[model samples]
Target: MNAVLIALLALPLLGAALMLAPIGDRQALRLGATVTGGTLLLAVALAAGFDHGDPGRMQAVTDVSWIPALDVRLHLGTDGISLPLLVLTALLTFLCALYSVKKLPAGPGGRAFTGLLLLLETGMLATFAVLDLVLFFLAFEIVLIPMYFLVSRWGSGKKTAAANRFILYTLLGSAVMLLGFLLIGVKAGTFDMVKLADAHGAGLSHTTQLVAALAVLVGLAVKAPAWPLHSWLPDAHTAAPTVGSVLLAGVMLKMGTYGLVRVLLPVVPDGTATFAPYLGAFAAVGIVYGSLACLALARAGAKGDLKRLIAYSSVGHMGFVLLGIASLTPTGLNGALFANIAHGLITGLLFFVVGAVKDRYGTADLDTLSGATGAALYGRAPRIGALLAFAAVASLGLPGLAGFWGELLAMYGAFDPAAGLSRPAFVTYMVLAGLGTLLTAGYLLIVVKRVCMGDPKQPAPVAELPDLQAHEAVSWTPLAALTLLAGLWPALLLGLSDPAVKHLLGGG
Candidate 1:
């Protein structure tokens, strides 16, 4: 079991190395992604083997002394909370890699991009698994480096400037976050997250605790790229390569939401209560703002802003997670956790489709792209168009697909918050958020009409091509299946998360 834990973390690192090897063939890069996916299958086995009745506690426990003199240890395990995110990280990483098979740049430039993505995948697994705070922070930081390079080097248009902007903003936030970690370690005399969460801020003064909480929020909000701080995301997403866009949307942003759950809420419950409304306000604005921006972009018919549109979609989806968290109810918490995976899967699929469209049509502009959706065009690429529709509609929280419950449950929880939360305030937020959901529906359907409706027409006349190739079929079909599975049977996810939520809420 310990060995399995280690393998789960190591597999992608090894995959990254193999892809970067001098062999230098695009086929080999793609093959490497498939091989890495095999590790995810191993994770699925772990998930199946999990003892469902006892899913709350860490299972498949593995601990090793790494820096005992300082009380640091290499510890990794999964509870209900970590399980879904881990699975999502693996699924999206695999799909992102698969997407790379077709989405990469024309030459040697593509090779390094694949390697960095694999490394990012490995880091995400480690960050989600590590139980120790210092280790978690370290693993968390590891996810940033490769992604910075992925954006700066292989990114498009404003790649260097965008990457620099992303890094600078995150670094500023991370500095404050690191200070928060050190404060916890100093006050609690341990760097273990379990130890600290178990302590529940008992060792620190109110002022001290609040300061640390704010510091951590600064860093995490930058990553969550919350309102005012979210400027970095549009640039990064627009400039990033397709696979980078996939990983960034699918898993990296979730890191911030996860941190809020893992660190701020548990470690500083009072601080969280004080700041919850403020956080919710930022999130609400991001939702309305992101959705509106996408509509404007689509309306203006800009060719290059397509990926940015999807990026804004992320802002809107994450707002739901924030809403759920702010509600401070088990249902909302569980819903947010589920949405993390749902959004990752759905948005990852969206980027894949957007990438494919750009590859085929050379642009993502709605006006310019009108004829591409004609019936004959669908005849030519029905699979891709259908998949895009699936992703876009699901993103709008379509009832039967993977995206349904987060907003519904978030509002439910808002109306009936846990005993500690302010009911009236949260209810108001919930009502406003519900209205935002309607707006979300509006924009997503617009994208659907623009991209998937018209009869087929050749923009200027060109050779015909087939829908999703074998690799795409492999990557997208399973996500679609899981989306449907979770949509129909949310119990598959809520069951795992409920216990963990219970523990976290009780100040675990």
Candidate 2:
């Protein structure tokens, strides 16, 4: 079991290291696909062997002393909370790698790009696996440089600025978060997350918990891009390349929210309690704001950049995730966990579809792609249009798709909240989130109507545009199928998470 966990981290790192050798474009692509494919298989095996009957306990733990003087250890493990995210990280990376094999945005697509992607994969996988605060922080920071390079080097419009803002904002947040982690470690006399969670703030004073929680939450929120802190996301997502966008939306944002549930909620329950109301308020604001922003973009027609609009939608989607975490109820946490995985699949597919659109039309501007009457997509490429529509509806939380269950469960959690939380406040948040969903449906439906329902102004040229490519079909099918599967059978995720959420919250 430990070997599986170790290999989960090592295979990608080794693949990345091997990428440093002189490799051609095709070789690099194949290598990346092969490595990520193996990683995905390992993740599946991890899930297969996971003690679902005892998901509350961390399994596949790999603990050893890495630095004796400081008592830091190379600790790693997973529970239901982390396991889904681990698999999600692997699955998305593998899909992206497969996509890259045939399609890379116009840039140097060989060794450097593939290597950075593998390195990024290593960090993300490690972030979910590590059980030591020091190691967790290290894993958290490891992704920044590679992602930065990917955006700046391979991305399109405003790439440099986007990458710069991403690095700067996240780096500042990480610095603050590290200080908080050190504070917790020093005061608690240990850095083991499992132990800290078990103690549940027993050794720490309220003041210390309060202070540390603020620092850590602020840092993680920046990554979560909660409310005002989310300014970097739209530009970053819009500017990043296709695979970059997929990975960013699909996997990276969850890191912040995952930290909230796994570390903040479990390790500093009191502090999280104190901040829950404010967090819920901010999350509520983000939900309405993101929906409204996407609504405006949707109405803008040609002026709207599809990629940027989807990025804003992420803000709203992640807001629901935050709202769930802030609720601090078993149902809410379960909802958060489920929402995390759903967003990864649905949004991943959305970006992939958008990437395909951009690849065909050379732009993601709604008007350019949609044509004068706002209906070139279906005419030009019916299959791709349908794919886009499917992804959009799924993202809007349609009833039978992956996106529906998470938001629904999250709202259900907010309706009652936890014992200590203000029911009235949470109910208000819930109301606003519900409104956000309506607005979400409005915008997404408008997008589908405008882009996929109308006829093309220039039928000849539009009809000449290609439909879904083989690589795209291969890359997108799993996400689409899983979205429907999870939506129709939400218990698949909820069951795995419920016990873990209970245990994290002291087995309530």
Candidate 3:
């Protein structure tokens, strides 16, 4: 089992190295698909063998001294909190790799694209798997390089500027986060996450925890792209290729929220308790802000870019995730984890569908897509239109979909936050979050109406648009299916995460 964990990390790195050898573009793509597919199988195996009875226990752990002098170890493991995200990373990467095989982005062939993607996978998987703070930071930072290249090289509009902004903002965040980690390591006497979490701020002073929490949370908020810090996401997502956008929304943003749960909460209980209200406040603001932004985009019609609207929607969705964490309760944490996975699937599929639309029409503008008049898509491409509508409904938190449970649980948790947090503040946040949901439904329904419900009276070029293709179907079906499955059986994820959440909040 330990070997399985190591292989999960090493396999993709090895495959990416092999991609550098002289090979045909087609062969490179095939190799990428095979490699990521194998990685996904390994993730499934880990899940199958995971001890559901003790989901809180770290399984398949690989701990060894990497720097004896500094007491830093090369530690890797997964608990219920991380297991779902690990599998999600693997599944999405494999699907993206498979999708790229058929629909390689322009400006680069299979070699550059596949290699960068595989490397990005390695970073993302390691971020969810590592147990040492130093190792975690390193893994988190490794993702930037490949992603920067992906956007600048293969992206569409303002690619260079977007990539530069993305890297600069995240790098600054990483720097501040590293400062927090160093403060903890120097004061706490070690950098091992397990030890720190077990101690639960025993040795650290109240002041240290407060400062560390502020710095760490700020850094992560930048990546979570929380309200004020989220300016980079829209441009980056709009410019990136389909696979790039999928991985960015589906996996990368989770790194920030995951760090909050896996590192901040247990490791800095005092700070988390003190700042819980503020976190909830900011989360509420982000929720409303993101929804309003999307509403503006949806109403833009021809001026709107579907990809950009989806990017704004992520801010609102991730706000719910942060809100869950802020509640600092077991149910809230579970909701955060559940929302993380749900967003990955629904948003990944949405990006894929939008990417397909852009491929057909050469733009994602609503009016141009539907025609100068209304109701052009249903006539031109019923399948794509239907897929868009389905994804939109799933994203809007419909009762029987994956999105509903998480937001519901998050708001419920806010209605009753942890013992020390102020009830009034949280209740206010809850009310605002609920309003954000209504706004969310409004914008998404607007999108469905404008993009999918139009008549079949489109012009000749619009009529010529192709329906969903085989490769697109293969890549997108799993996400749609899992969205429905998880929606109907919320316990599939809640079961794995509930115990772990309890243990984390209970101080191990």
Candidate 4:
């Protein structure tokens, strides 16, 4: 088990290293796909071997002392909580690699692009695997460098500025988070996540725990980019290339929310209780804010970029996740976890479709691409249009899709919060969140009507353009299928998470 886990981390690094060996672009692409594919297989094996009945306990643990003086160990493990994310990281990275095989970003360094992607995969996988706070922090920070390079080097307009903003915001957040970790580490005399969470910061004074929790929550909220802090996301997504947007929305955003469930709630229960109401408020506000932003952009006629609008939609989806976390009930946490995976599949697919739109039409301009106004995309590229509509509907939380359960359950949690929480406050949040759902439906339907429904105003040259290329079909089919499968069988993911969440919340 230990060997398999180590191999999962090592394979990506090895692939990255090989990219430096004077490899040609074709070979580099091949190597990237091969490495990520292998990693995905390993992730699957890990899941197959997981003891689902005992998922509350970490499985395949590999613990060894690495820094004796500091009481930090080289611990790696996964529970039901981390397993889904682990698989998500592997699956998305592999798909990105496959997508790059034919549609490599317009950049000079194909080798560097593939290499950095592999490295990014390593950091993401490691972040979920590590069970030591210090090691987790290290793995968490490792992803920033490669992603910064990815955005700055390969992105479009104002890429450098966007990259700088992303780095500044995340680095500051991470620094504050580190301080919180250090405070708990010093007080507990160890950085083992399992021990710290089990203790629930019992060793620290109430005031100390509260202070540390504030610092940690603030830091994570920034990464989660809850409301005011989320300004960086739009620009970053707008400037980023297709694959960058896919991974950023699909995998990176989950890191902050994952920390909330994995680190904050368990390690500092008192702190989480103290701040839960306020967290719920912020989440509710973000939901409305994100939806309104999308509506305003949609109203902007030809000026709005589809990619940026999708980025705003992400903020709204994440608000549901945050609301679930703030509820701090087993049902809420389950919803949050389910939403995490659903967002990855649905939004990742959305980004891919948007990227293809831009690639084929030279822009993701709504008025220009809208079938009602310009190209009549459904008539020109029927397959791409159909796929885009499917992704958008799923994202809007349509019935019988992956996005439905999470939002529905989250609202339910807010309606009936945990035992100790304030009922009035959560009910208010529930109402607000319910309204946000209406807004979500409104904006998405508007987009669909404009882009997919109307007759061709000025039909694009069908012969020159293509719809759902071979590589794209290969990369997208699994996500589309899973969205339906999980929707129909919510238990597939919910079952895995319920026991673990129950254990965390002391329901066991």
Q: Which is the leading candidate under lDDT?
A: 3
Query: How does each model score on lDDT?
Result: 0.80, 0.92, 0.92, 0.89
Every model's Cα RMSD, please? 2.2, 1.2, 1.0, 1.5
Tens-place lDDT digits, model 3, residues 104-124? 999778898889999999999
Candidate 3 regions with alpha-carbon error over 4 angstroms: 300-302, 460-463
Model 4 Cα lDDT, one tens digit per residue, 242-311? 9999999999999999989988888888888899999999999999999998888776364778999999
Across residues 213-325, which tens digit of lDDT does each residue of candidate 1 receive? 88888889888868778889999998887878888988989999998888887787777777787887787777788788787776633552678888887888898888888
Candidate 3, residue 452: how far the Cα is off, in Å: 0.6
Which 10-residue window in model 2 sums to the lowest lDDT? 455-464
TM-score for each model: 0.94, 0.98, 0.99, 0.98
Give a tens-digit lDDT track for model 2, residues 404-452. 9899888988999999999999999999999999999999998898778
RMSD of 2: 1.2
Candidate order by TM-score, decreasing, is 3, 2, 4, 1
Ranking by lDDT: 3, 2, 4, 1
Error (Å) of candidate 4 at residue 376 is: 2.2
**Candidates 1 and 2 compared by lDDT, better number:** 2
